[model samples]
Target: MTEYSAFKVELTEHVVHVQIDRPEKANAMDAAFWSEIVDIFQWIDDTDAIRAVVISGAGKHFSAGIDLALLASVASQLGQDVGRNARQLRRTILRMQASFNAVDQCRKPVLAAIHGQCIGGAIDLVAACDMRYCSSDAQFSIKEIDMGMAADVGTLQRLPRIVGDGVLRELAYTGRRVQADEALRIGLVNRVYADPEALLVEVLDIARQIAAKSPIAVAGTKAMLSYMRDHRIDDGLDYIATWNAAMLQSEDLRIAMAAHLGKQRPTFRD
Candidate 1:
């Protein structure tokens, strides 16, 4: 039970629940957050017992986005050399981007259970998830436009695929809040619940279901899906054919077949 400064993590029945724990500050992404998240998701990736993950906020809001104090600190570190400042800024942005990249690269399925205000960088966070679900009270925004900057993280890149180009452009350009129903309509969220409590209950159940599946099958599916994002259909087919050539021989496949023939629920190893 390792503790974290910006998050609370728990593992139950092969599912990991990762909560942004800074409710008092609306779970703002500070320096600690940017660094700690990469570590947390990496741990999730390496732990075989973690078959699925659910990410959510602790209290009122999912997040208020990047903490202004962190921005101010970065600003304070800037000096008179414009070239040096540019290099430093690029490094900082890339570091922040890697935090979400870790979530995207995790082998386990990552599900976002959002509630309240999921704004700015929080949008980037959930954009990296495999699936998203929210409560009726959830309000999402691509808020960097309101802050006088473009979103430089995963939101601008990953969201176009999730919400489609036109809808993503409207949200990113306008910085308007999309309520839960609209989120569902635009394919941003799979489902919406009456409240956060109900949202977590159902989303966790979904994670449990996914966790019950053969880990090898799930990981291969996720791998192929991620590969297809940048590759052509033919390339993806070739890659998967090569992948399954080795993967199909896994013992879990035999276990799954036996369980199916026996008319019993499959129990897979971690």
Candidate 2:
């Protein structure tokens, strides 16, 4: 219900649709974007009525990445003090990292509906999502290297696991665009639609499927999988065993069983 300067937010049924609103700027990540994204996802994490989320851009492109003006501002802020400048830049990078980290950390499954160009910072945003679906015209790039810096956000840390080391490194090194077909082949996107409108329909259909499931199970599965991604096999096994031992008792399980026996769809309360 809150107004956002950089995004248009809509909640219908149980899925929250978030669109980057700055079409004129190609949805570039400016000051409002970097800070508002962190706030939005943190809010999503706490809202119980929400079950799934879909992110897309308002106009042609998903995003053109960080705004040049913002970068110039950051450059100006850097000073002659070697130790102080390093510390300041590190802190700045961490804040930018947190913007997308919120999406990664959200308990609910997040799906990205991408179109046109998904550039540097845009890549970071989608990398944190649980699933990605793009338009046939979409293209992605790891452009930070060309900008004289490494990708310091979720892309570097998260993308290698999605795509392999060879693919990720090649993309990072070359800063070349990966078109929709190649992106799908590389496992960067689950599916590619004919266009942005079609992309939204399919992504929303998937989000609705997720929203229809038992929240307890979906949230627990998401959390467990996220945990397992960072932990060893045995550690993950033990963790899930403990988690389900307590979480398995939700009323939704009983509802699901009853629905199965009655040949009906299960309805869950938030």
Candidate 3:
């Protein structure tokens, strides 16, 4: 139920639908967008009403990347001292990156539905999601190299693991556009639908399925998987072992077993 100028969040049947609402500006991330995103994701982490999340844009384009106007403002703020300016820019980059990191850290699974163009910051945004789906016509690019800068957000760090070593390097080095079919082939997206409307429908359907699961189990799974993403197998096993020691006490397992035996659907608490 949080209202934001950059995003609209809807909590329906335990799934949080979050749409970037600046379609008039191609949903470009501005200074406000950066700050607001952090708040949104932090709220996601805290809210019990949300069991899953689906994120997309409000119109034809998912996003056009960071707004040039915001970049210009940042450039203007770089005062005379090169050393001080570099330090300030580093802090700014870290702050912006945290916005996406918050999304990565949320307990609820996040699914992205993309259409039209999703470039630069848009790609970084989706890379943080648990799943990504797109329209057949959607296009993506890591455009920072073309702009004479490296992508300072989570893309370079995260996308490599999602897409793998070779593909990530090529995309980062070239700044080329990846059309929907190619994205599907390269594993950048889970699926490509016929259109944006259909993309949202299917993405939300999947989100609803995840929402129907036990929240305690779902959150533990997300937390464990994210932890395992950067840890060794033995380490992950040990971590999950320690985790479930306490988590196994949840009433969800008993409820799930009863529902299964009764041949009925179980309702999970928020």
Candidate 4:
């Protein structure tokens, strides 16, 4: 995998840990930062060694939305030629959106371990993850309103699916910060730890647990769940049935059945 200045990537067993490295900037998203995120996930997809992933920030905060300097630079560039700049801006935004989309598309489950502030684009990142855990000090907000725009990224769409339309509306419209307790109550975070260190330990433990499962089964289940989320019930049923048809023929199932019959733990290939 390529070395990234804005992020760090480490692989252990079957879990990939990705940390935002720009602590001085509160891990803010800039063009290079988003590019690196997309690259790392693509690397994960290419490498069979990684079966699950955990994401977090390096500093006190998870992220502080878009970098103010990047935003200013784009705004200044837009003044040069409105029409051309508008198209360029749209393309750039879409590229950044693809970074988060990679998390959703990854075959392995992606878990977010958030701390401090997770606002705007940070919310987009977490929303794309398969599950979220956070520190008790973590706070989240759909901060696009504060930036004078509706969130154009995945947050507006994905967050509603996670927290319901009413809750999403209240938060997005107001841009008010939601503490970890409130996030947990609304199902935004699955668990909250006392602090960042504890949060890291808990999240990594969860990741390792997930990594121990049969890779084929885990990947198939993740794919099926994602399909079900966007499809009708009948369609989802059909899809799962087709998936199972192929999956049932794998050696893992035979191994699992034999292990069950013998009252022993099943071993699976990574």
How does candidate 3 fare on TM-score? 0.98
Q: What TM-score, over all chains together, does every model reach? A: 0.99, 0.98, 0.98, 0.96
Q: What's the CA RMSD of model 1 in angstroms?
A: 0.7
Q: Which candidate should be chosen as best, given lDDT against the real structure?
A: 1
lDDT of 1 at 60: 93
Report residue 106 deviation for candidate 3 (angstroms): 0.8
Off by over 4 Å in 1: none
Ordering by TM-score? 1, 2, 3, 4
Error of 1 at 21 (Å): 0.1
lDDT of 1: 0.95
Displacement of the residue 25 alpha carbon in candidate 4, Å: 1.3
Give the per-residue lDDT of model 4 (tens digit) for 1-270.
568998989998789999999999899987788788888988998887898999999989999988888888878777577789889999988887888899889999999999999989899999999999999999999999987998987998798889999999999999999999999999999998999999999999999988877889999999998998889999999998998999988998998889999998888987
Q: Can you tell me which runs of candidate 3 are displaced by over 4 Å?
A: none
Kindly list the per-residue Cα lDDT of model 1 for residues 35-114, writing each as its tens digit: 99999998999999999999999999989899999999999999999999999999999999999999999999999999
Could you tell me which residue pairs clash in candidate 2?
none
How far out, in Å, is residue 191 in model 3?
0.9
Write model 2 residue lDDT over 189-219, tens digit each, in one string: 9999999999999999999999999999999
- Cand. 1 TM to true fold: 0.99
**TM-score of candidate 2 against the unseen true structure:** 0.98
Candidate 2: minimum summed lDDT over ten consecutive residues — where?
A: 36-45
